[model samples]
Target: MDERLSVAPVVPRFAAAIREVAAVTAFYAGGSIGSGDYRPGISDLDLVAVIAAPLTRARRDRLRSLHRTLGVAKLHCAYVSLPDISDVSRKHVNWAHERMFRRPLSGISRAELHQFGVTVYGPSPAELVPQIGREELATAARAELRGYWTGAVRRARVWRTDLHVDLGLTTVSRAGVTIETGRLITKREAIDRLPALGVPDDLTDEIRRRRAGEPVELTEPQIRARAVVARALMREQLTRLLG
Candidate 1:
């Protein structure tokens, strides 16, 4: 917490890759990774890597190093291009990244850099990231509630592990706060705020256990029930702010 950048052993390699490869113009540690909630056992090394141009061969290899060296389970950094950040409609490439990533580049991630990001090896997150409005952030959060989480438990069986439940619940809770406040909150803050934010107590407890390293198991019905409540809470919060 004392250090501005708290990260895993793999971070040195990430910075090294940025320095070694010319294609990466900048990189910033983001989300909880930047918010001083970094837990080596539970947290991920969230990042935003800005590309100098296209995903060139050298740049492509550098991106690949993230997954290969850091491992998919522990890292989820997005590789963004300037055009998408500048033009609002250019559409950041996700297909290329999906081959080696857990998720794709996001506009909110770009926006978060300006608000909550920690600079690791960048020109400062504020200077490098283009401004993305609150509506855009609200729009993205709403879609994830209606589209992504709604189907995630159904398609992938979300409650099979505590990790999924924790992430799903934590994401929606903090997302609500972010949508309303135009700022991201730490996991601790999100958990504390969940009750007033309309998150179910059982789901909130599970999230706590997930963070405490306590063993947790949920039935399919339990997960489905919780996911329904979470999705609804996010929907209400996002609508109130966005509308």
Candidate 2:
């Protein structure tokens, strides 16, 4: 692991919390933290924990309480049983945005685990998670756009928010790259590619500066205009890639 790819201070603490609640066989960190693109107070901490067995109702309650007590915002993790590691289709216990639910371990996340996962405890990601092929990666990226973004693009109200604009545009750019090349690029890289994807230069600059911890504000009219532009670009990219 590069010296720069250090886990956030909260990771070890979270891992310790996991041990207190359940038996974690292996724990790993992926996403921005694993890719060396983490921006303190900006990027999310994506994590995975391979546990000894499936979560029981009691354990789920405990885990939920643990996440609430920790109070670390933007920290999301999927808890998978050792047996479920080989199957991406199986739903597992997940915590995101302070909510606990069941969702499958996504293909992109599995690929990240194999590529650059940082071991907070237990074996490396490749040692446990299966290697995902390029075609599989491309297929997964397409499903995300076709499934989620399709619904998201239909909701005009969400596009007006900064979160939607930043995430929507970057997601399309990143998904397009994945579909074409079968490689995952960091969010920062996706942001840099926004202008080339026909996103307005000013909006691109706002996203870049905002991600860098700079304060950015847009007037209501400006936000509405950007929302229209972003939705159009996302719809165009989705058609181009999914077709």
Candidate 3:
């Protein structure tokens, strides 16, 4: 632990909380914490755990309480059943504080889990997650670029926030890189490579400034323009591949 892990100070408490969950067999950390790129007050702790089965309402509520007690600002702990760890076809439901959603672990997530994700409890993530092929990852990345992100930008009605500027930059840059190379890069790496990703310097600076907790505002027009530009960049990379 580099001590930057938001949960590091509370690992014992986190450990205590997980142990209380009788269903949790294995827990692996992900996101920035997994990559050791944690930015104080910015990067949240991401955890993926294998459970005996789908967490019951009582168990879910109990786990949520632990997060409050732990006092970690952003903790994303998702649960996959023991049988579902290797079931790539199965969509797993994970609980992030209050939200419960279905999203199968992506190849990028697997790469990080296996390469650097720390085990909070139970077995190693490598033992639980199967190896993912780069081709498969590339395919998925392309699909996301064409579908989710293309829609994501257009649907956004808000800007000038940390999530709108800083988070958006990371996702766009990461998606662009992954679509082209099928490799997962850290958030910092994504920022550093934004120029090569065809991101305009103004937008890049927007992310940097927002990340530093500066107060910045972008008009609705500016936000929409940034979204269009990002989508265009992605489409360009996507086009070159086919050409």
lDDT of each: 0.65, 0.87, 0.67
lDDT of 2 at 107: 92
Clashes of each: 0, 0, 0
Q: Which candidate is the best by TM-score?
A: 2
Candidate 3 lDDT over 69-106, as tens digits, reads 66665666667777777766577766564565677776
Off by over 4 Å in 3: 1-8, 64-72, 156-162, 217-243
TM-score versus the correct structure, for each prediction: 0.75, 0.95, 0.78
Give one digit per residue, the lDDT tens place, for model 2 in 1-243: 345445487887788789757789888889988788899889998999999899999999999988998899999999989988899899999999989999999899999888768888888887889888999999889888887888988999999888888888889889989889888998899999988898878888999998889999778899888889988998898888889
Clashes of 2: 0
- RMSD list, candidates in order: 4.1, 1.5, 3.5
Q: List where candidate 2 sits over 4 angstroms from the true fold.
A: 1-7
TM-score of 1: 0.75
Lowest lDDT 10-residue stretch of candidate 1? 93-102
Among residues 3 or more apart in sequence or in different chains, the pairs in candidate 2 whose N, CA or C atoms overlap within 3 Å are none
- C-alpha lDDT of residue 195 in model 1: 78
Q: Order candidates by lDDT, high to low.
A: 2, 3, 1
Compared with the true structure, what per-residue lDDT tens digits does model 1 show for residues 1-243?
226563564664665565545466777777776677777767766767776775666666765765565454656556667655566445443323335433445666666677778776758877867777878877766666665666664544444456555676677777777677767678888787777767777778867877867778767787677656655665565455445
Evaluated at residue 110, the lDDT of candidate 3 is 74
